[model samples]
Target chain A: MTTKRSITVTVNGQQHQTEVEPRMLLVHYLREVLDLTGTHIGCNTSQCGACVVMLNGEAIKSCTVLAVQADGGEVLTIEGLAPEGGLHPIQEGFWEKHGLQCGFCTPGMIMASYQLLKNNPHPTETEIRRGLEGNICRCTGYQNIVKAVQDASERMSTSAETPVPAGD
Target chain B: MSVPAAFDYHPATSVDEAIALLQQYGDEAKLLAGGHSLIPAMKLRLSQPEHLIDIGKISSLSYIREEQDHIVIGGLTTYVQIEQSDLLRKHFPLLPEATSMVGDQQVRNRGTIGGSIAHSDPAADLPGVVLALKAEIVVQGPQGKRTIPADDFFVDTFTTALAPDEILIEFRLPKATGSTGSAYDKLANKASHYAIAGCAAVITRGQDGSCSAASIAITGATVRTIRARAVENALVGKQLSETVIAEAVSHATDGEDMIVDIHGSEEYRRKMAAVVARRAIMRALERI
Candidate 1:
C-alpha cells in the first residue's frame, strides 16, 4: 500500500494544507480536493490544453504534474485569473471577441494566453498561433481565439500609462 | 478517475539525495522531473513503477550558461527557459528553435531537457538535434559523475546509457566554429505531439566557401535518431549547391531502421526523411 503525505501548497493565492496519496495528480487536487473545478481534464494524455495552469508563473499541464511534485509551490488556476470583480483583460477579450462556442477550452486557453501576454505583451499573429499551438479548441476553428489575443494585446497596451519594458 | 497505482514518493532537494534515493529503490524507482511524460504513462499504466523520486524542486539544476569552450544546460531547465534564454539565442540558436516547436506552450513550460533526453523517444526533436550538435550528457550516480557523448548516450528505442542509480545532470554542446550553422526541420503530427519525420543538420564552411564538415541526424524515421553518414560524406568537400544538397538528401535513410506505425508507413517515412534532411541541410548551409 502507498503512504499518504502532508503537503502545503498555495493555490490561487490561498494556502491549503492537505494530506494526499502519492498518486494524486495536481489536477485532481485542484478539482476534487480543493473544489476548484475550473481546471478541467479533457484528455488523460497531455495532448489537450484543458488541464493547463500556471505553476510558479509558468503555464503547464496540471494533469501531468503530481500533487507531491507541486508541494510548497504556488499555483494559479482559471479561478485566480479574475480575482477582482472585474474580469482579466484576456477573459474580457474572449467574451467580446466570441472566442468560444461550448466554452470547454476557455479556462485553459485563457490561462495559456495570459502566460504568453505576460512574457510577450504584444505578440504578432503568427507568434500568437505558435503560442497557442498546444491548446486544442475543438470548436470555433481558432479564428476568434486569435482575434481575442490580438484584442487583449491592444487593450492592455492602451490601458497602461507607464510603458513596460519589452520582453518581460 | 481512479488514482494512479500505489507508489512511494521521495522528494529530493539535491543531486546527492536524489542519487541515494534511486540507489535505495534500485530499478523500481523512476526520477520525476516535470512529469510531462512519465506521469502520463503511469496514468495509462504503461509504467507502473514502485516509487517516484521527484527532482523538480532542485532549483540548482535549472540553468543555461556559456562556459569557456561549451554551452552547459542544467538537466532540469524547462523548454520554456531555453526558449527565453538570451544565452541560447546567441550561442545555440538551433536548440531554442527546436525547443520552441515542442508540444505547445504548456508542455514547454513543464518538460525539461534532461527528462526528454532520458526518455529518449526516437521521435523527439531534442535528441536528434543534440546528436547532430555532438553534445555530451553528464550523469551523476552513486559511484560518481561521468560524461557520455550524445551518440553513445542513446542505446536503443526509448533507452539511454543511464544506470539505475544515475541521474542525468546536464547537457553540454561545444561552441560552433566559424562559418558553422545548424537547423532543425520537423513534420509534426496534428493531434499527437510526436513527430512524423524530423531532421537536424550542422554544416561548417571551409575558407574557400565549400563545405568542410557536415553532420545530419534524423529522428521519427527510425528506432533511434541516427546520423546520416552517407549525407555527411557526400557534403564534405562539395560546394553548397542545390544538386549536392539533393544528392546528400537522397542518402539520408540509407542505413536507417525506421519505425512503421499508423501515422505513416515505413516507405513514406523513408521518403520524407530524405526530403526533410535536404531541406534542413539547405537551410543550415544558407545561414553559414
Candidate 2:
C-alpha cells in the first residue's frame, strides 16, 4: 500500500523524471531504477560510506536520504566521475595504485575522496586518513587507499581538472 | 531489510507550513530535517511515522547571522555550515570545534544542528555544547513562537520540550563579551564515532585573574546531557589552578547515572567523564 510520488533528479549530469514510493531510499533509486549500481549499499544503514554520493555539491550517504527528498536536486555518483574512454584522476589514482583488495568499497571511497579533495586540493596524509573515517575497508586496511587519495590530490592539482560536463 | 515503513512525504517550504503539518498529522507525523537521524531510525523500524514533514529545504530558515545583540542561527543550518561559518568561528569557536567532532565528513555535510539538539541523543555533542553556552531555543506552533532556555528544553534522551504541533525554528545565543573562552573535548567510539565521554566548558575570565562566570556540561556519560553544577560551583570565584580545576572536574559525574552500553561500562565512563571535563575546562582557560 505504498503511494508513488513524482520526482525529478539530475544524476551524473543527466536529468530524469520518475515516480517513487515515499519509502524508497536514494541509494535504492540509484541502484534499482536508474540502473546505476556502482553506488554500493554496504551497510544499508548510514554508518557505512559505501553509499556516499555528492548531493548539491556536498557528499552525503544516499542510503539515509529518501528518494523524494532529493527532488529537483543534482546528484553525482561514482560512475559519473569520468566520461567514456577516460578515467577521472581519482579513479586513475586507484588504478595506478592498488587501491582495492576486494573493490567492494572503492566506488564509495572514490566518491568521498572527490568531495574531500574538492574542498582541500592538497591534503596531508593525516587529513586524507581523517577524510575516509566514514568509509570502512574490512580487507584492505586503508594504507593503499590513503596513498590513492594522495596520488589523486597531486594529479588533480597538477592541472585544472575540468568539471564533469552536464548531459554530454 | 532496513526499509522504512510506507509514509506520506510532505516538503514544507516555510516554517508556518511545517508547523501546520505537524498540527494536522499530530502523533502520526515526524518532522524531517536533514534526515540524518530520523531516516536511520526509521530504517530500523524503530520509528514508523505515517507522515514525514520535511523542512530540510526551507531556505529562509537556513542562515547564520547577528540579529540585535544575539547570534541567531536558523534551525535548518547543517553541521558543515556551522563548522565552516566565519561568524560562529570568530565569536563561538567551541561550536565549530564541537561540530567537527560530530560525525565524519559526509555526516557533517548533512546533519543539522537543530535536528541534533531536537533528537537529544544522550551521546550527541551539541546538546552539551548548547547547554554550556546557554542557547535560547525558539519554537513555533499554532499558538505562535516562544523561547525556551536550553536547560529546560532537553527533557530526556531522544526527547525535547517541543510540542507535537511545534517546530524548533531558531537558536539565539547572547553575544559573548569580556574575556570569555570556551572549549569541548570528547572520547568517541572509534567505529561509530558516538561520544563515549564528552564535555563542553564556557568560562569568562575576570579582571582579577580569577574565574568569573563558568558553565560546564557533560554528555555520553549520563542518561541525558547534563550541566555539571558541582563542577561549575567549584570553579567560580576561584583561581583556576591545575589542582583547583582538577578538583572541580572530579565531580563531573557527581549525582549522575553513567550510561552503560557497548561503548563502555558505567565505571569506565564515570572515569572518562572527569578526564574529558578537565581537559575541556583547561582548554577553555588557555583560550581565556
Candidate 3:
C-alpha cells in the first residue's frame, strides 16, 4: 500500500495544489496530473536528460525527482517558455536554426539551454557545446542545436537591459 | 516509465532530526542526499528502502568553510558549488576538476560530495581523490560525532563503515601547503560517463625538486578505492621525471581484484590504471 502526499508547487508562476503518492515522480505529476506533457521521459533514467526542467531556476532531471520532493518549489517546463502570442528567443532560435528532427528531445534541450543562456548571455562555441552536454539530441547531431543556443544567446543579450551573470 | 516502489518519505530539517529518523527506521531507511544516485537506484529497483529520510533541505549541512589549518565542507555541498568555488579552484584544483568530470551540468548541480562518498562507487571520482588527499569524514549517530579516516571508510563495493543509525556530516581536508600538487585523471565511459579507470595523485616536492611525499589513489580498477602505497613509496625522494614517475605508477594495479565488466576486461583496466596514474603523477608534478 502507498501513502498519498499533498504538495503545493508553483509551476511557471502558477500555484498548484495536488495530492500525489510518495512514489509518484515529478515527470508523471506534470504530465498526468497537470497535463503539462512538454516534459518528455527518455531512457526513464537520469542519464538521458529528456525530462529536464527548471527547478527554482536550476535545470534538473524531473524523472529522477519524486513529486513529493519538489514540494513548495517553483518548476518551469517547456510549456512556459513562450508568451501568449509569440515565442521566447530560445524557441525562436530552434525554429530559425531547425534544432530538431524527430522533436523528441527539443523540450529538454530548450529548458537546459534556457538556464545556460540565462547564466552566460554570450558563450563561446565550445562553451555552448559543453553547456548542452546534459541534454542529448539523437536527431540533429547537435550542430543545429548548438547554433540555436548561440543564436538565442545573441538575441537575448541584445534585447535585455542588464544581462544576468552566471551564479557563483 | 521506471517508478520507485512504495516508500515513506520524510524531509528532515536538522541533523538531530535526521539522526533520530535514521534511528527509528533502522536499516530499512535510506538517506536521500542530492538524489542523483539514490533516485536512479530506487527507480531501477536496485534499492527498495521502506522509508526515505531526505536530508537535502537541511540548510545547516550545506556549507564550505576554511578552518584553522584545514578546509571543512559540509556533507550536502553540491558538486556544482564545489566546481565553482574560487577557494577550491585555487587551493584544491583536483577536487573541482574531478568534480567537473562527474556528469553534465544538471547532475553536478544536484549531486553532493557526502552522498558520493557514502555511495562509495568504485568507479566514482571523488572517493579516489579524497583518499589521495587524506581527507577525514565526520559521522554522527546516537552516541555522538566521530571522525573516520578516508582509508578506513570504504569497506567494499557499495558499502562503507557507516552504521545504520549514522549520518556522514562533513569532510575535513588539510589545506594544501607550498610545493604540494594534486591531479585527477580519468578515462570515462562515453555512454554513462562513469570512469573506466581513474587515478588521483598528490605530491609534495622539496626545494631540490625531489619528491618529499607522494600519495597515489586508484579507482575503477578495484572493488574499492585504494591508495597505491607501492607507487607512493617509489616516488618519494626521487626526482619526478617522465621515466621515474612512469616506473612508480606501474604498480597502481598490483595486488587488486580489478573490476571486469562490459566496460573493459581485467587486463585492459590494469593497463589503463597505470596509464591514468602516470598521467595524474605527471600532471601533479607540473602543478607543483
Candidate 4:
C-alpha cells in the first residue's frame, strides 16, 4: 500500500493543506497537485536548478526535496515573490535588463537571485555568478541575468527592506 | 519525472526517537536528512528502503558549537550553516571552502554535513575535509552511543562504518589552534558538480616555521576518500617551500585505488590527483 502524508504549506501567501504521496517531489506537488506551474523542472537529477524555491526563507532545489519533507513549512515560490498589484523588483529588473531569453530558466534564476540579493544585498559580479551556479540557462548566456540581479540589488538597497508587499 | 518508490515515512522529532525508529526498522529503514543525496539516489532506483525516517525536522541535531577541545557540529547541520559559520571560518576554514564547492547555493541550503559524510560518496567533499581534520563522528545505536574516528568512519564508496541500526548524531572536529592552516582545492566535473579530483590539506607549523604536523586527504580519484600518509610524512619536520610541497604532493596517487569513469581515465585521474593535492597544500601553506 502507498503511504500518504499530510502537509500544510504556505505558497505565495496562501495556505494549502494537501495529502501527498511520500515519494512525490515538492516540484511535482507544486505543479501537478497545486497547479502552481510557475516552478519548472529542468533536470530531475538535481544538476539544474529550475526547481529552486524558498523553503523557510532559504533557497533550495524543490526537485530534490520530497513533498512530505516540506510539511508544515513556509514555502515562497516564484509566484509569491510579487504583490497582487505589481511585480517584485527582481521581476522588474529582469524585464528592464532582459535577463532571460526563452524564459524557461528565468523562474529559478530569479528565485536564486532573490536569495543572493537578500543575503549579500550588494554582491559583486563574481559573487552573483557564484550565487547562481546551481541554475543553468541555455539562453542569454547569463550576462543579462547578472545585470538584472545587480539592478534589483540597487533598487532594493535604495528602497525599504520589504520588497515583497504584504496584506494582499 | 523521477519518483521514489512508495515507502512508509516517519518524521522523527528527537535523537532518541530517531534511534528507536532505526532500531525497529533495522536494515529496512534509512534516515533521511537533507535528502539532497538519498532522494536523488532513490529516484534513480539506485537505493531502495522500505521505510524512511525523516530526521530533517529534528531541530536538536542541527547546530555548530565550540567545545573545550573540539568543535561539535550537529548531525543535521546544513552546508549553508557551515559555510556561514564564523567559528568554522575563523578556525577550520577548510570546511567552508570544501562546502562551497559541493553544489550550489540551493544544494548547500539543504545538504547536511552528516548526510554527506554518512552517505560516504567517493567524490563527496565533506569526507575528504573530515578525514584531513581528523574528526570523529558520534553514533547512537540500540546498545549505546559510540565515537568513530574519520579514518574508520568511511569504509567504502556509498558505505560507512554505521550499522543498520546506528544513527550518526554529531561530528566532533579537533579545535584548530596556533599556526594552523587548512585548504581545499578541487577540479569540479562541470556537469555533475562532483569532483574529478579534490584534495584537502591541514598543516600546523612549529615556532621555528617548520611543519610540526600535517595531514592530507584526497577524494574523487579513488573509490573512497584516502589520507595521503606519504604526503604527510614528507611534509613533517620540513620547511614548506614550493619545491618541497611539490615533491610531497606528487605521492598523492601512490598506494591508492583509482577510479576510472567516463569523466576521466585511471591515468588522468591519478595525475590530476597530484595536481590538486599540490594546489591544496600550497594554499594551506599560504594561509599559515
* Candidate closest to the true structure, highest lDDT: 2
Clashes of 2: 0
Candidate 2 residue-wise lDDT, A1-168, digit = tens? 657899999999999899899999999999999999999999877777999999888888999999998899999998888887789999988887889988998899999999889889899999998888899898865998998888888898786765554422
Q: What is the lDDT of residue B26 in candidate 2?
A: 94
| Local error of candidate 3 at residue B57 (angstroms) | 0.1
DockQ of 4: 0.87
Local distance difference test values of all predictions, in order: 0.87, 0.90, 0.89, 0.89
lDDT assessment of candidate 4 = 0.89
Ranking by DockQ: 4, 2, 3, 1
lDDT at B281 for candidate 1? Answer: 86
Give the Å error, residue A97, model 4: 1.0
Could you tell me how far off, in angstroms, the CA of residue B213 lies in candidate 3 after the best superposition?
Answer: 0.8
Candidate 4, TM-score vs. the true structure?
Answer: 0.97
Instruction: For model 3 chain B, give the 10-residue run with minimal summed lDDT.
Output: B84-93
lDDT of 4 by residue, A57-104 (tens): 888899999988888778888888886677888998999999989999
Q: Model 1 over residues A1-168: C-alpha lDDT tens digits?
A: 988999988987788999999899999999999999999899768787898888877888888888887887888888877655768778888999999999999988998898899889999999999888878898855999999999988888877642232211
**Residue B230 Cα positional deviation in candidate 4, in Å, after optimal superposition:** 1.0
Q: Candidate 3's residue-wise lDDT over A1-168, tens digit each?
A: 757789999987788999888889999999999999989999787777899998877999998888888998988888877645668888888999998889999999988888888778789989988888887877755999988988888888787543332210
| Model 4 spans with C-alpha error above 4 angstroms | A160-162, A165-168
**Number of backbone-clashing residue pairs for each candidate, in the order shown:** 0, 0, 0, 0
In candidate 3, position B152 carries an lDDT of: 97
Cα lDDT tens digits for candidate 2, B1-288: 689999998889888889889989999999999888899999999999999999999988899998778899998899999999999988888999999998799999889998998899999999999999999999999999999999998898888998889988899999888999999999998876889999999999899989998999999999999999999999999999999998998899998877998889998998999999999998998887
Give the range where candidate 1 chain B is weakest over 10 consecutive residues by summed lDDT.
B1-10
Candidate 4 residue A145 C-alpha distance from true site, Å: 0.9
List TM-score per model, in order: 0.95, 0.98, 0.97, 0.97
